[model samples]
Target: MNGNVPASTRTLRVLTFLATQPGPVPMERIASAVGLPRSSTYHLLKAMISEGFVVHLPEEKRYGLGVAAFEIGSAYLRHDPLERLARPLLAQLVAEIGQTAHLGVLHGRELVYLLKEQPPRPVTLVTDVGVRLPATLTASGRALLAELPPAQVRALFPTPESFVRRTEQGPQTLTQLRRILADEKRQGYAVEDSHITPGVASVASAAVDHAGHPVAAISVTFRTDAIPSSERFLLARRTRQAADALTRRLRG
Candidate 1:
């Protein structure tokens, strides 16, 4: 609360305050909570809004965390603790399924791979850690998207250009994407076939938080021909189990 504190520190304090709040707060409350002068707080909030770390709802005269803030928090989770915790689970999934497995999280309109585990006989995959693919075209992405609120999903894919096609095989518009998400919601899992890589199919389930918000997706990728149609349900069930296990770990 000292006047000597750096502006950057003050900004972070304001952000932390907004994060702890249940909903958007008035500027006056934010200034008092962060111990900044009202004028300085107003300036800081304007800057944060422009940079997308905060959002100002004009009608309500309140401020809240923005998509950029959520992205930053998600980036933090993509590092050490999440990857370490998922490695063994992914390894176990590969051992049981005899396929390649990966962990991915939504980054804007893309699903960014964070971890990958391969069996002894691995199928060729483009989903290595650090690779990114269109969210609508990948099972892992769909799993995460299906858990998001409909309005948020629309914001992420607002236009035709937002739809990125890696192959000629997946949704190309908002309507198509919505239909796919609807199916994912009802089925409790997601599936993709030859969308990212030809002849490769994937099954995925979302790893959710205690509030049921998807934090990440767990997916197993394999040769389409290798998995018989009759056994696809078993694969989906196993993927869901891995996802549920991670969700429990996160909640703990």
Candidate 2:
């Protein structure tokens, strides 16, 4: 209701409203929704259109987000501080667990490794910084995916072909993936045994943001038999603790 607010704040409000819409909206609706006067909203839209953050559809008499908005979103993904904040935590996790630890973020249907830390005497692992793996086959990927809405998960894996198998040990269909994700959601963490690499096991937890959306996952991987079955739960608890720490750091 304050008409004298800063331009930057009002602009951000307008953009946020537009982002929640299913499609383009008319200028009148945007102005009413964002509580801006028609004239002021028009001016803001004009400036945004000129800057390529909004596009005006003359034929439909509506406005929609433009390429610049998408670029900004992409930039946020690229510049997110997740890696820098999780680096030392990953190192500590590996030291405590005596296994290789990794930080991964979901990229479409894949999980991209952004950081990896190994113990003083570590086992060789296929997971390395810059490596990408199928989301359904890795604990890191499953951890991130489990936090997402089911419809979003469905969108990410539309067909059976969307499922990629490294070994014959993981989910190969939507139903199976959903089952695995359900178990993860209930357990508060995810696990993969010989999915990405034979004789290797990984346990992971998602690092969520202020909005409770997962921004990344922290995982620890080791030989299947390196840790006894009874103690594996302790490793998972430690991984989840590390993930929660990163989440707190991000929210803080």
Candidate 3:
């Protein structure tokens, strides 16, 4: 409380101050430098700790930026490059496939679509840029999830409650989801039928980084009537090709 300076402003000041430091700094110094009472600083830090914006090193009595903070910084730097590489590919995919295509990234346990493309005679779809959906439910989300380590996947979904419902489809438990992900991983692609919206289906593949971790997913969604389940893997293969192209660009 620096004479009515907002808590949000003060927290930002603390983050700015911490960013200037070479590494973690002790609480006393942070509170003093940010001009906040020690008690208020402690509470603010606790909140940040819960949200993964800050980490507490108990033995050293120090605080530092956490992985979430790192992700935010990395995202800022990556936004232009990732989108620049994917936009044209999505446009091309829509044109060639005559369907809707999208680029999605995982945000926490959900999929956040970052880019979307529609064919000239597009069918209206519920998914669009910035729309978030359950990772265990969408084809593209599963494609991304399939690339993550099993342990990380378990950590992301520890219990049955984590599985959300949409159109009464998709897995209801971690065990069931793992089974589906395993098949999708082995197939090198993923597919969903009416999992998000009724009468719609999608095929997807993940773009991997140099380290072989999934960086994003490319998916094409079409009406179930337009594409037969028996022949949907054709779309799957096409999506994989697009994803692989993006993977190479990211790797280079």
Candidate 4:
């Protein structure tokens, strides 16, 4: 539209705009937002859709991010920028709550710990940096899963074998897992009671990105007998607060 900008710049501009939107949008909206002519925008979108950087919804006549864009995001995670952003917050949570805290991210059907902070009280948790666990059984994983779309959840856990067990707790069926995720989503946080290690419980909240997808989870683990049900609410709120802070940092 204006003085000639490079096609590469225009492509990057379009991709940036799509990342900020809440969901799919008509081509006209993307064209108008990026200051491109309708025909040029159409051509650009066609090219992106072909490469898997954009997805075309023929029925709705709209476009959103595709698998390629997500793959790039996953590459970013490999560089551990999230772990850098989350370390201090995890340390603060441990200091304030006197509980072992962790930062975890979803990896396929499991959750991977990226950072862990333990208080001086010597609380021992099975999770540590680089540890992975079944997403359905851990509060950290559940918080991340609760924010995902239902269809995506179904795709991740289509059968009982997908629900690997660390203990006798957690959902064993897709129906039960969906119900558990719904309750966690409604409650604003996810909880685990001896789900990983007996006599230990954890609470977690998800840190979301600009598109409202969960990027990571913040969790705190404590001994069950040491804290009553009433105090658990306070811990849940604290984890949520840390997660919200992490989300803000991510958006920035």
Candidate 5:
């Protein structure tokens, strides 16, 4: 790595550092971490704050990655080759499973839908692109949750009181959530019924990124009463294959 990069490059590096840190990082800490002069660090921070890449907390006097950072980070999804590359795969999964397919990323304890493929049948689902759903109440959420560390999961939900039950079937507490995630991990995917909408069942698998983190989930939703016990295995297998294919595309 070059010790002396241009000012523009240094500013970019500072933003990168703040992004990877997860939470607020103080100006002095940023200076020390990036090995920049205090004056330069302050100037860079001020500029980034103005540009919305960083936010300054007047009360705490600490700096954190801002909404602009989140937007910019999410923008990567728009141009992401994985989503484009995975569309046909999602359609194929829906075709094979005879159910709706969805691709969602975990966003601050929520599942943000990135893409969805609807089945051709008369009965369909409402997992439209760009819709956000509760991560704790959906199979896709559980599938992604299964890959996260217990501490990270705890940090995401904070408390049992924060858990919102969408239906009688959903997990009502953190203990229940942890147990569900553990089961999903053991089973290699997550399965849930009538959690989001009564009479609907879903199964999801985690789509991992290059870091081996569960970046997203691929799910299939169908009418609970319609899916036979014999077809459940096929649905799970096809959903897993879609997730695996998406992960491979993402890694490439």
Candidate 6:
């Protein structure tokens, strides 16, 4: 076995620790967390900072994620093969469910709608492609959160103050959000009704990577009263199926 760690492994460990930590971590904290010598950690940090994957806080002398990290993430969306594969599947979802279907990815603390498929109906939905919404308040967000490790989930929204409600039904605190994610995990889907708009409801499930991290979520949004009670589970199941198919195609 190799006695020394590779530079790639060291950088990954540092990034993962920073991601899981609640806030910007100091150089010392990163060194302790990644089990690297202080001098080596500083050198690694300097290289990462130069590459734009990490940023240093001049005021607090701490480090946080930077723009280049987001570019790497945006690359996932821009170059994704899933979108091409998902178009036919999402079209089927829209046709069968008689509602709009969406594919959303979690970006930082927000869910960005990457694609929106509207059914051939007289009424149209307000949600469009490229819309951004509060993740803690959306069905797609909850589905993604269900796939996250618990500690990372907590770090994403550390306190009640971290939750920003776009509507009255949204979770009001970290405890409440935790409970929601738990329920979503148990049920294998997430439900959001009247969170963004009155009379609107959505149910979703995640598209997970090979490591079981959520890459995105598939959802169906429609008028709450228009959907029959018996069909709700079916809709949820369809969303999950679409998500699973997309994940398999992407990860495999």
lDDT of 4 by residue, 1-252 (tens): 574899999999999998887677899999999999999999999999888788777777888876567557654763568888898999998989888999888877888888889998758778998898998999999999898766457656768988887788899999999999999999999999998999999999999988898889999998999889999999999999999999999999
lDDT of 6 by residue, 1-252 (tens): 132889999899888877665557789989888888888889999999898787777667788765466446645864557578678778988888778999888876788888888877724665667888888888998898777765456556767877886766788887888888999999999999889888888999988765465778888998888998788998899898998888888776
Each candidate: how many clashes? 0, 0, 0, 0, 0, 0
What is the lDDT of every predicted structure here? 0.87, 0.84, 0.84, 0.87, 0.78, 0.80
The better-scoring model by lDDT among 5 and 6 is: 6
Q: What is the lDDT of residue 16 in candidate 6?
A: 80
Q: Which whole-number lDDT from 0 to 100 does residue 172 have in model 5?
A: 71
Each candidate's TM vs. the true structure?
0.80, 0.74, 0.72, 0.75, 0.72, 0.76
Model 1, clash count?
Answer: 0
lDDT of 5 by residue, 1-101 (tens): 25567888888788777756645667888988888988888988889878867777665667876546645554576456758877889888877766788
Expressed as tens digits, the lDDT of each residue in 57-110 for candidate 2 is: 777788877656745543364354767799999989887777899988877778
In angstroms, give how far residue 55 of model 1 lies from its true place.
5.6
Candidate 2 clashing pairs? none
- Stretches of candidate 3 above 4 Å error? 1-78
lDDT of 3 by residue, 199-231 (tens): 999999999876566789999999999988777
Q: How are the candidates ranked when ordered by TM-score, highest leading?
A: 1, 6, 4, 2, 3, 5
TM-score of 4: 0.75
TM-score of 2: 0.74
lDDT of 3 at 220: 95
Clash-forming residue pairs, model 4: none
Name the runs in model 1 displaced over 4 angstroms. 1-48, 54-65
Give the 10-residue window scoring lowest on summed lDDT in candidate 4. 70-79
